[model samples]
Target: MNLFADIRALVISALDALAAEGALPDGLDTANVAVEPPRDPAHGDMATNAAMVLAKPAKAKPRDIAEALAPKLEADARIAAAEVAGPGFLNIRLASPVWQEVVARVLREGTAFGRSEMGQGQRVNVEYVSANPTGPLHVGHTRGAVFGDALASLLEYSGHEVTREYYINDGGAQVDVLARSVYNRYLEAHDLDVDWPEGTYPGDYLIAVGEALKDKVGDAYLDQPEDVWLADVRDFATDAMMDLIRADLALLGVEMDVFSSEKALYGTGKIEAAIAALDEKGLIYRGTLEPPKGKLPEDWEPREQTLFRSTDYGDDVDRPIKKSDGGWTYFAPDIAYHYDKTQRGFDQLIDVFGADHGGYVKRMKAAVAALTDGRVPLDIKLTQLVKLMQDGEQLKMSKRAGTFVTLADVVDLVGRDVTRFVMLTRKNDAPLDFDVSKALEQSKDNPVYYVQYAHARVQSVLRKAREQGIDVSEAALAGADLSGLTHPAEQALAAKLAEWPRLVEIAARTHEPHRVAFYLYELASGLHGLWNLGNTESALRFLQDDPAHSAAKIALPCAVSLVIAAGLGILGVAPAMEMR
Candidate 1:
């Protein structure tokens, strides 16, 4: 039901026919030809650049090629006219019934109307929200979590076999810090005074993990040394924090298919195996890095460490796998995790990290490049910081003040739906402002409200139509006399409906789910425009005096609601059936 693709295929076949007649040179590369909507609606319903692309290759003027191709295109009933533009552009005006047919097609397909097979069930792994198992997730991790979860949903809707995964960084210094923080809480549980240290987590959220540890093994490790209790407490505290993370994600309606532990990668020979695989490719070496690009640190000294020749794969310099103290660097476990992903035989990989990790992108990409030898492509998306505002003032999140915003705070303030939609309104690399006041406003200025209102308005029309005894089921609507839907407003609404399938393909191809959110807003705008037209023009109304005529006109807006529901579904935003 993709009119654009259908027309593009027609243009390609027409070019093949031209080659058969020797009208144009045989084998002029047509891969670059594009069929898209004309910039100006006056030009035509669709436009193609086939003639222009084949002109130089076929050794013929573009106008001559367009003129020759016009007659060939006119033979199809769907194309009303194929006029040659300034040079070689072929401007096509589709018959009114062509777009009218799209409305009926949408009604028949319902939410499945714009679904695409572009992914074709190829396995894809998307790793996001790899936040360390510390306290509750903060604002920054929320953006990445929403973005990655929505992307996984979008890919699955478009037919990709997607795995939603989170990499728990528990095997790091941070988790030990969490353990010590819990240790302090454990001492606090024993009614003893403890001073909060500088490097330990000072958040109140860890107090519960401490209390729970006291409940599990009450006062047994109260006076024990760090070595005697560090491992047991670290394991217990990390598990509790992960449980908290899972609950926080559930608050925002997110569920990961897998939770990969960095601890599992350690002591399993998995890191060794992954590093050895890279070593087989000559990517590993024992070397010392030159001082960083500008000034060298005062403590900088040349020291031999286990390094990876990342520069060979386009990194700025070689990377250290093991620190000078004979322990793995932070990147060692990361590389091993990605290697695990590659060995799982996924067709592609996508990592969603915070934008602060921008410097690490080149090295990680180089690691994947060398590990898989470019067999699997890795797409890393960095989510920028999300700023919080309220009442014309910056909302300070000082952990010491116990005033930091948690994911639960945001979700509880407005809602999970508003939180998810607002986070997705901007690109992953662009900063997002989540205003508590503006997000809750019930006006068009808020996209979450605007798009949801559109779906609700359409539902109102359908409910009214059904209450009046008009059959508005999809089966009945599919058979409506759609040709009666010829009003300018009706046709404009139909045009928006045609863009859904194309939008799905574009969003999936680029791994950008935010585009779906943007498209939903535009679609809602078009719908609201048509709904408003009913105020001044009687014909623009969804339900007219004539039941059959009203059915035809009603189909357009109902289709609009259907596509909005689909888009909202991908974004994990619930579509409203009535404005609250």
Candidate 2:
């Protein structure tokens, strides 16, 4: 149960009672009223800003409103005290039984304790890691992949029907470059001397693909012209690279529900349909854009091109949808792709992009807004770069990837669980420095280890209880007499446990999975704190002299493990049952 939500409801009920008695203004809007934990724990268990926010609207002094509301709240069986703090902020202290009930509820609910229905089953499409199918996914794409996958999982945990998607950039010139590069490698396979060109991919990863192409074709394209082999080799190389990418994603536990192809949009009338729909709204025009803001390039010209009036939807300027040569511009297919998504009837959309795409955000938003006629909302989250370091030095590039470290390299070095958890230790928009040595270290500085250790420690306590002939099952602990868990440390951890549901709703609402990671670290810290206390305070230990007392004491840490497992599950991490 969300204790904060319950208390906020109680405050609303009290405010309604005041309005009923004419002690406050009639029809006072209480939407902004909030009940949350006090910033300083010494203040109280919870605090509300009902009086402060409603003062001007209700035409009453905040202190008078708080003073009138205090008695009504205190009269409830849950509230121990409702004290009026500075500036009419009402601080509330719940009875000890409230925290006790939280522990029992956690035990009863298990890992489902924090699951929420806030999304109301709305369909959401989360598109991420749409790297070009030309080579292995690099570290930058890894950050986006992890962030997007975690976000999709977070949405699902909140009851959204989420589809994790990858948009293949196969329709671009890059794929053609990939074809030529593979052809060069193919000639090398046939014992031909090939000079490496500047724009061709020279990575060794394509060597196997080239050899495979030779095995299949067997001299069919030998000494052929560009037209005869370009299309066939492009298709073959794209498929092979995609296979490599799929394997790389598997290394990090990432899977896509849909892999949409950009090439499918070409020669299929999808791009035309998307642009025509926008044109029907008077957004398309033949116009020349203003020269970009700095020194104009020597080849710059005011050529009339097919443009979308993106400024109408808040973009800085109109955007080109087609070139003067009558070929579709890069943005045309993207608009079509999102239009395709909207047609699939998703209520909302989220695109996870690398930080380098920051410039493309407003234009894409404007396109979705125009395409949906402002019906659907699109959120673009740009994940910042990840700096992989080891022993105080930046790690070198991967030989296979040629220029950058592949996602597979990182996963192979640190493992899927550590790679995923460490990627989200910072906000999606913040730069993350993932130190390999630190990630593997069993120390508090390592967030993933610290969180896992908390879960493992609880499992150890439960195992000890089991050895002492105590029934440590969830049903038994849930039915235990938890009244004895009144120590300051125990109470504090229970309070933290009470915050899980609230935290889930907040993180899901903000589309930030980093909040879940941060909360897990704090909750783990709380459990660790209580575990340390048991060393000096014998009565606080889980395995006590009396079975009943032991059951009551062990229930708190048991609930802690349950919640940790739940949080880790959202992050796609398997909680460790024991540490080495």
Best by lDDT: 2
User: Judged by TM-score, which candidate is best?
Assistant: 2
> For candidate 2, lDDT tens digit of each residue in 419-493?
999999999999989999999999999999999999999999889889989999999998999999888889999
Least accurate 10 contiguous residues by lDDT in model 2: 294-303
In model 2, state the lDDT of residue 487: 88
Backbone clash tally for model 1?
0
Question: What lDDT does the true structure give each of the candidates?
Answer: 0.89, 0.93
CA RMSD per model (angstroms):
1.6, 1.0
- Every model's TM-score: 0.97, 0.99
> What tens-digit string does per-residue lDDT give for candidate 1 at 160-186?
999999999988889899899999999
Q: After superposition, how far is residue 561 of candidate 1 from its true place, in Å?
A: 0.7
Error of 1 at 118 (Å): 0.9
TM-score of 2: 0.99
